[model samples]
Target: MKIAFYGSSLLSSYWNGAATYYRGILGELARHGHEITFYEPDAFDRQQHRDIDPPDWCRSVVYPATEEAMRSVLAEAGAADIVVKANGVGVFDRELLEGVIAQARPGALKIFWDVDAAATLDEMRADPAHPVRAALPDLDMVLTYGGGPPVVDAYRAFGAKLCEPVYNALDPATHHPVAPDAAFTADLAFLGNRLPDREARVEEFFLRPAASLPERRFLIGGNGWDSKPMPGNVRHLGHVYTHQHNAFNCTPLAVLNVARDSMANVGFSPATRVFEAAGAAACLITDAWEGIEQFLTPDTEVLVARDGQDVADHLAALTPERARAIGQAALARVKAQHTYALRGVQVDALLRAQMKGANA
Candidate 1:
C-alpha cells in the first residue's frame, strides 16, 4: 500500500518524544514492501534539524505549513491508498486533516495518528486554542502510539469513527544489547527531558535516590536537565541523540523509566526507552505505573521504584547475578514479542482492514 504521513519532523527527535516512534514505524513499514511518503511542514525548522535521512526505503515530502502548499500536498496525497495526519505536526495539520478528508479520492483512508494522545486530549480539553476541537468528530480513525485500554474507549466516546492503540515496540535489529562503557556506565541512569509535571516525580523517584546513594554513580541525560541541581554522584549529559540511545541504555547498571503525567495515568504504555533499555540488556528501575506488569514482570523483569528507598533497594539490594538475570529476561521478552517488526504486522493488518472497509 502507498501511505502518506502528514506528521511532525521525521528526522528531528532532539526534544521530540515521538521521534523514535516515527523512525521505527516508517522503517518497519518500508521493510514490509509498502511505499511511504512522509510529508512534513517546512515550519519549525524540522528539515534543518533532520536527525535521520530518508533510509533509502521511502520518500520525504517537505511542504510549507501554509494553506496553499497543503492543498497541493493533499492533492498529491489523494493518490495514496492511506494518508495519516498525526497530531503535533503544526497548525497546518488541522488543515491537513480537512483537505484529505474533504478532497481525498474515493477509497482513500484518513487516520488521525495521535503520537501523544494523553497530552493532546489534555491540551484540547483544557484550552479553547486547540485547533482540532471541532474537526475531530469527522476523523475516520484515531490511532495512538502509547496508551492502554482506557485511551481507545475515551477516543471513541469523543466521536472518533474508529480508535486503536499502537503500543511502543522495539526494533531489535537496530536496538540490540551492546557493550557497556565505563564513562557512560553507572549504577543508575535516567534519560528524559525536563517537563513540569514530570519534574516532581523525577525529583522524588530519581534524583532523591541519587542523593541517598552518595557513593554510587548515577547519570541523567536529556535536554533542559542541564541547569538542574544534582547530587555530586549524579552526572548530567544533556540531550543524548537517537543513535546514542543504545549506548546510554547499555551502560547503565539499571536504567530508570519516568513517565509523564499522562503516561502514568494511562497505564501499560512504556516508551521507546523501556524496550530499548531491555533490548540492551540493562536492568530497569522505573517509577510505579499501574499497568507495568503487562509489559515487564516487576521484581523479575524490572524493579518498581516509587521513592529514594525503592531506588536504593533496586540499586543495592539486588545481587549483581540476579540483576543480570532480570535484564536478560527483559531482553528475551523484547526479542520474542516487542520488536517494531511485530508492530508493522499489526499496523499493516489494520490498514488492510480499514482499506477494505473504505472500498466496500
Candidate 2:
C-alpha cells in the first residue's frame, strides 16, 4: 500500500509530541512493504530543529506552510492507497481535512488519524460545526493514538464509519536502555512540552512533589518550562532532544507521566512518554487514569499516583533496588505486548481489511 500521511513534523520532536508515534507506526508500516510518503508543513520553526533526517523508510515532503503548497500536496493524494490527515498539523488544518477527502480517488481510504483524540472530541462536542465533525461522515475511518472505547464510541456517534484506538507503543530500536548520563541524574524527572492543558497537572504531580521532597533532585526537560516557578531542588533543562531521551529516562531514579487535563479525564489515553520510559527500563510513576492496567500492571510494572501526595509517598518509599525491579518488569511487559512491531502488524491488518471491504 502507498500511504500519504499528512501530519506534524516527523523529522522534528521540537514542539510536536506525535513525532515518535508517527515514526514508530509509519516506519514499521514501511517495513511491512508499504510505501509511505509523509507530508509535513514547514511551520513553527520545526525545520530549524529537526532531530532526525528523512529515513530510508519513508519519503518525507516538507512543504512551505502556504495555501499553494497545501494545494499542491492535496493534488498528490489521489495516488495513495490511503490518505491520512492526522490531527494537529499546526497550519491550515481545516483546509487539509476537507481537501484530503476531496482529493482521494474513489475506492481509496481516507482516514482522520487523531493523535489527540480527547481534545478533538471535546472540540467537536462543543461545536457541532467543527471541521473534523463535518469530515467524520465522509472519512472511511478514524484512528486514534490513545483514546479507547469512549473515543471510538464518540466518533461513531458523530457518523464515522469506523473508529479504532491504535495506542502508543515503544520503538525499541530508537528508545532502549542506555548508560546513565550524569547531567540527567535525578530522583525523579518529567519531560513534556509545557502547555496550557498540562501545566496545572504538572504543578500537581511534579512540582508539588518536588517541593515536598526538598532533599531529592528533580529534573524537568521540555520546551517553554524555563520560566515556570519550581522548587529549589528541581532542575529545568529546557528542550531535551529526542536522541537524549533514552539517557534522560535511564538516569533518573524514576520518571513521571502527567497526562493533559483532557486525556486524564477521558481515561485510557496513555501518553507516548509512558511507553518511552518503559522501553528504557525507567521506573514510571504516572498520574491516576483509567485503563492503565490494560497496558502495564500497577504496583509491579508501573506505579500509579492519585495526586501530588501519592507521588511524594511513592518517592519516599522507593528504594533503588525496588525501582530497578519495577523498571525491568515494565520493560518486559512492553517488549512482549507493546512494541511498535506488534502495533504495525495490527495496523497493517486493519488497513488491508478496509481495502478489501471497499473492493468487495
Candidate 3:
C-alpha cells in the first residue's frame, strides 16, 4: 500500500513528542513492503533542530507553513491508497484534517491518527463545534496511540465509523540498553517537554520527590524547563536530543514516567516514555494510572507511585540489585510481546481487512 501521512516533523523530536512513535510505526510499515510519504510543515523551529535526516524507510517532504504549500501537498497525497492526517501538526491542522478527506481519491481510506487522544477528546467535549468532532463522521477510521477503551468509546460517541487504540511499543533497533554515561548519571531522571497539562504533574511526581530526598541526585531533560524553579538536588539539562535519549535512560539508576493530566484522568494511556525506558532496561517509576498491567506487571516489571510521597518512598527503598531485577523483567516482557515489528504486523492486517471490506 502507498500511504501518505500528514503529521509533525519526522526528522525532529525537538518539541514534538510523537516523533518516536511515527518513526517506529512507519519504519516498520515500510519494512512490511508498504510505501510511505511523510508530509510535515516547517514550523515551530523543528526543522532547524532536526535530529535525523530523511530516512531510508520513507520519503519526507518538509513544506512551508503556507496555504499554497499545504494545498499542493494535499493534491499530491490524493494519489495514495491511504491518507492519514495525524493530530498536532502545529500548523494548519484544521485545513489538513478536512482537506485530506475532501481530496482523497475514490475508494481511498481516510484516517485520523491521534497521538494524544485523551486531550483531543477533552477538547471535542468542551466544544461541540470542534473541527475533529465535525470530521469524525467523514473519516473512515480513527487510530489512537493510547487511551484504550475510553478513547475508543469517546470517538464512537462522536460518530466515528471505526475506532481503535494502537498503543506505544518499543523499537529495539532505535532504543536499547547502552553503557551508562557520567554526564547523565543520577538517581532519577525525567525527560518530557513542559506543557500546561503536564507541568503540574511533573511538579507533583518529580519536583516534590526531589525536594524530599535532598541527598539523592535528580535530573530533568526537556525543552522549556531551564527557567523553572527546582530543588538544589535536581539538575536541569534542557532539550536532550533524540540521539541522547538512550544514554539518558541508561545512566539513571531509575527513570520516571509522568503522564499528562488528561491521560492520567482517562487512564489506560501510557506515554511513549514508558516503553522507551523499559526497552533500555532502566528501572521505571510511573505515576499511578489504571490499566498499566495490560502492558507491564506492577511491582515486578514497573513501580507504581500514587503521589510525590510514594515516589520518595520507592526511591528510598530501591536497592541496586532490586532495581536491576525490575529493569531486566521489564525488558524481557517488552521484547517478548511489545515491539514495533509486532505492532506493524497488527496494523497491516487491520488495514488489509478494512480495504477488503470496502471493496466488498
| Model 1 TM-score (2 dp) | 0.93
Quality of model 1 by C-alpha lDDT: 0.81
Q: Which sections of candidate 2 miss by over 4 Å?
A: none
TM-score of each predicted structure versus truth: 0.93, 0.99, 0.99
How much lDDT does each candidate structure score?
0.81, 0.95, 0.93
Q: Write candidate 3's Cα lDDT for 1-360 as tens digits.
A: 999999998999989999989998999899999899999999999999999999998999999999999999999878999999999998899999999999998888999999999999999989999999999888899999999888899899899999999889999988899999999999999999999999999999999999999999999999999889999999999988888988999998899999999999989988889999999999999999989999999999999999999999999999989999999999999999899999899889888888888878
Give the range where candidate 2 is weakest over 10 consecutive residues by summed lDDT: 146-155
Provide the lDDT at 108 for model 2.
Answer: 95
lDDT string, candidate 2, 1-360, tens digits:
999999999999999999999999998999899999999999999999999999998999999999999999999999999999999999999999999999999999999999999999999999979999999879999999987898889889999999999999999999999999999989999999999999999999999999999999999999999889889999999888999999999999999999999999988899999999999999999999999999999999999999999999999999999999999999999999999999999999999999999999
What TM-score does model 3 achieve against the real structure? 0.99
Q: TM-score-based ranking, best first?
A: 2, 3, 1
Off by over 4 Å in 1: 42-49, 64-72, 127-130
Q: For model 1, which pairs clash?
A: 11-51
Better of 1 and 3 by lDDT: 3
Residue 155, model 3: lDDT of 93
